[model samples]
Target: MPGSEAIRELVAACVGKVGGPLVALRKIVSAHGHIDDEHVGIVADVFNLSLADVRGIVSFYSDFRTTPRGRRHIRICQAEACQAVGSRRLTREVAEALGVELGATSEDLGVSLEAVYCLGLCASGPCATVDERVVVRVTREELLR
Candidate 1:
């Protein structure tokens, strides 16, 4: 975790900028992996917002995480197109194989499983992402490897 001074400096740099609070939060996440309570306080103070306001922003955005993700993150598409192509079955199988439920990280923090609404590969439905790399027509066998 960065020292409070460091966090304040980071947040201060975003002052007078557009969407300062959101930008500051993103910067903090980029530097520290996730935003914690201390970060939320610093951001709120620097941006002249309430703690609830900053917390609300963090909670509202799926991209923002209050905790660090695992080393390998897997996002299985659950959109209409992907579901039509057996993504539901694939999701269940992958979750079982990984030993982690959706929206959860493994005990060893080596892997995380999450549900994504879409990956824009509708034509190739049943898509998933392994550490940010999109895998089309994904299968349980392919994901385990």
Candidate 2:
């Protein structure tokens, strides 16, 4: 976590004259990987919002992770379309292989596994996005690779 002073400076730069809390959050996340309490407080102060309000925003959005992610991030589709194609089993295999549950990061921070509602690849059910690259018809062996 960065010091309060550093967070204030970063917040000042990200928060424009026009309101863009979502965009500012993205910028902060991109720069720091995650938004800690200090970051949230800084943002709330800059935006003139309460701490709880800022926390609510963070919790409402799936993209805003409160904790740090691993070097590699993995998001598997878990919606009806993906589930129909055996995404459940694939998710299990991935969790086992990585030794971490969904929404958790590996001990060594090698990977962060998360379940997304959809990747907009219904045709390619059981799809996954690894580091922002979409992979269709993902299999356990392929993911392990």
The candidate that achieves the highest lDDT relative to the unseen native structure: 1
* Residue 7, model 2: Cα distance from true site in angstroms: 3.3
**Per-residue alpha-carbon lDDT of candidate 1 for residues 31-78, written as tens digits (9 for 90 to 100):** 887899999999988888999999999999877878778889889999
TM-score for each predicted model, relative to the true structure: 0.91, 0.92
Candidate with the greatest TM-score versus the true structure: 2
| Tens-digit lDDT string for candidate 2 (1-145) | 5566766776777666465676677777877888888788888988888999989989999999998898888988999999999999999989998898999999899999999998888988889988988999998887778
lDDT of 1 at 14: 97
Count of residue pairs whose backbone atoms collide, per candidate: 0, 0
Residue pairs with backbone atoms closer than 3 Å in model 1 (clashes): none
Sum up the clashes in candidate 1: 0
lDDT of 2: 0.86
